[model samples]
Target: MSDAWSHDEVIYPELGRILSESQGERNEEIAYALAICAGYAYAEVKGGADKVTLRKRLARVGLQDNTCKPIELSVDAMFIDSTAFVVRACEGKVAILCYRGTEIADLTDWLTDIDTEPETYSFPQAPDRRNWRVHSGFYRSTRATWDDVMAELASAGPEALYITGHSLGGAMAAMAGVMLRKDQDPRHRQVRDALKAVYTYGQPMIGNVEFARECQADPFLRDNVIRHVHRNDIVPHLPPVATGPFAHFGTEFRYLNDPPGLESPSGYWRRNASARQAGMIDFALTPWEFVARRIPMAGSLVARWRPIGAKIEAVADRVEKAADTLHVPFGRPPSFVCYSIEDHAPHHYIAKLATPGVLSEFERERTSVS
Candidate 1:
């Protein structure tokens, strides 16, 4: 057994040797360790940031758009075979197309493979109602798009519709569900009532108060919408604000604490509220910062001009920073409370308000006809 083989796993003699010998493998190893350490120090870290560094990393890897223009592309191009996966997952079900701005080009593969016989179209373009002051381009356009998608779904048949996406895709899926409930067309009503579940990972908030409440109003929708958020993944908390009253409506929030065999980096990014405030100084300044600095300018487009980029950066940074602060779910009093997963109410209570019980159990007793 060599000194480097202390445990079952092989060990590098030194950092320099590992860097030179391992090459590309070293960076991933370091990142994994950093992710783990970060989890332990998460509470003490200011701003309660998650995925802050990861987002920056992704930006470095050329995964962002620097253009300040509204996104208009499809949802299939963002991930590996994302569109194909979406199609496989959503076959037969009438799908409501929702997504982050106009970055549809990223999703072209998915769109191209869609069965042309059952057509799909887009929502009218407009600004998002949630965070009204901010121009997210999710609200008006998505609302119109939902109406059209619903009409098509109704025509197809009264059956469940599948909603899917990552990041902006996820947010769009949430918005579509909201519109499904808000509208009252006879065809829409039938389709909405018979809707299938929405499963979106890393979704951002889409609408404001009215839309959220509408989504929450439907018990079916609320019960059916499941959102999965990675603990350190920052995309889900973007564009800031709960656009609607039930922004978290019909969306069962699932927290992925961390991957089992990963480590986080030490040294948290201090949550300097002052720095955050500075980031939001004005649109005239700091437009193209961080990820925003990288979008390829189309022709002589002023959208990609340096000055415009800086202004956008300032706003985006503030929104990102603000979102970081609100990561924890609202309403649970901060304290050291403990209980087993199997505990019930009263003597063995879980939270002050709840105990171990399934929604189905509650429903069964309530619906038992006397």
Candidate 2:
């Protein structure tokens, strides 16, 4: 009923107990438990609820107010240490779940190969193009990555699967959710088919028109994929021009003013806010800047390593231009847009370019840059 509900108030202890028992394994319980906790934490920050209020609510669900603590959070991962219990739901049955954070030897396989051969790729160079096909290549690559990840999960035949990630990880999770919904692999199809949901926090836009349509049309993807974004976190504002499924993804933009300080309760909240804002900004500008400048040797390698005459440079130009054009229609610019005393000027970095009158120039820049 309110903007957001506290985890303790919202999560049922009896349900948690039942889920844990049914899951039958500590690792599975840990995974589902943390996801549920993460979802609650997201709600608290987004809603701007007081810490005391959230803590009191968590107590209702059998967790102590002091149990939750912030831990290391990485690009594609997060680690939270909390004493709170978790429940697992699988194949229409609740149990204590079993899970492993990762068993794959090279989890980095999904990422763009920028490390080993840094100078191979420059950003895609192209003309000013807003067509659907222009964006499909990036979408397809990410989609395929998730498909592969889900296929591996399907092999294990788990009860119910919950996927989550922050920022790029979130983007990856959304793609995984889409593929898991329609996965036909009969081996672990039961668990794949029983996917509980996906929760992506501060996830960027990952795909284009048809890709969005495919995600929205699938029953599992439509209801289970929950994406949360902080109001001024610009990374989520990427791959512009939504098809169908992504139309509403950016609408529920989460707003937080500052990082929670570690010294006090309020400080803790502010530190989280600050960290999220910083992380989002970094996610958007860092890699592209590196790629755009042709700095990473591996990147240049990937660019040149492409199929004969790959239009990598040309495509990158259009992506930059398109990002400039697609302004989110959220109700208002975030308070931090004006208040934050940051050296990097996010508000006006591409300001004039976003104006209707400047389209030709943005296009011109797109063409000549490549």
Candidate 3:
């Protein structure tokens, strides 16, 4: 809606409206969208590009450069350091924490190593304050990413604290929300209270049924977490309920490119969801198909930063093995394949959000004015 992005034909009406003006949480929503752009920035790093390229990539996506240098931080969690997890602020108010998705070089292998049956871990800052538990793997990964991100978020004192990612990053973003929401750090009570919204795309279930239930059972926490899942995207349903009882948290926004009634809901999708639809995803990925179609192309067109080569064959083997496991007892459920690799692309998400028709009435009005 700003003259800056007027040239973009597929304006994200809601996002466009937010960009044009400042009001209550308008900037907050805009900030969340910007976080997705930043998430892609981290994802590009997986291809082994340098920081200058990262800055250029951010600019290409319409993000203004940050004036403050100290706030640009990286994660050092148990899984990965720097690139895998990063917190960057754009346009001042929106403080975004981005978690990078999986990459071919150890990316597929790392995902394959994820514990099917995740244990529960208590918050290190809990006990004396509150008793909350999270997926063992997610909690450990969060600590490794940053033990005190909650602390930093509180100190920022922004109107909204936006946490986001795609694929694995999405799951981590949700986990980060859980940790911050239940944070017992007396000093961070403000940050915990300051959380306004959480957005994730193509993310998987970060916890089991218990985790989902706990989050849904609470009204305050429930409203703040929103998930944008492309219909039939299997990445959102992985670890298959067969291997684990993992379920998702947050309100679901299901969009399949012009599907009727997929508009913003007045309530949670889980409580109001209709029957499942047939999957358009093709789960049959041959070793060659993965290496040829999935791996190298995982990096978006914006950057050629890929970790490619002969090692990809090994990663492709893991992909086949993962496909096998996606089936029974320890693999994917019969319904899991309903979601496919094509639905998981981050660019598609950005494109979908930008579609003009998805805008609300107010968004449309703003578009006319702009």
Please tell me which predicted candidate would have the highest lDDT against the true structure.
3
* CA-only RMSD, every prediction: 21.1, 19.2, 10.9
Per-residue lDDT tens digits of candidate 1, residues 34-94? Answer: 1221121111123222333423322222212111111132333322221111111112332
Compute each candidate's TM-score over C-alphas. Answer: 0.37, 0.38, 0.62
Clashes (N, CA, C under 3 Å) per candidate? 46, 52, 13
TM-score of 1: 0.37
Candidate achieving higher lDDT, 1 or 2: 2
lDDT of 3 by residue, 1-370 (tens): 3543343332243443243343323233453354445445443333452345444344433444532221222333434332333334444455556665554455432542264446565545333643344455555555564554555555566554566677666777778887777667788776666466667777777776666767776664476566776644657756544555666777767554343575433222222131122222323432223344445555342113222321343354456557757853342223322235666777666545542333421122233435
Of the candidates shown, which would achieve the greatest TM-score relative to the real structure?
3
Candidate 2 residue runs with Cα over 4 Å from true position: 1-152, 240-253, 256-370
Backbone-clash count (model 2): 52
Per residue, candidate 2 scores C-alpha lDDT tens digits across 1-370 of 3433332232333434443243222222232233333334332343232344333434443333222222112233212111111222333243111111111232432232111111111112113322222123223334433433444454445455555544444554565555455555576577665566665554555554444544566555655565544433444544322222222222232333333442211111111111112224433444554454355775565344433222332344345446647853333222122112121222211221122212211121122221
TM-score of 2: 0.38
Of 1 and 3, which scores higher on lDDT?
A: 3
Model 3 lDDT, full chain set: 0.50
**Candidate 2 positional error at 93, Å:** 7.0
lDDT of 3 at 298: 52
Return the lDDT, model 3, position 49: 27
The per-residue C-alpha lDDT of model 1 at residue 73 equals 23
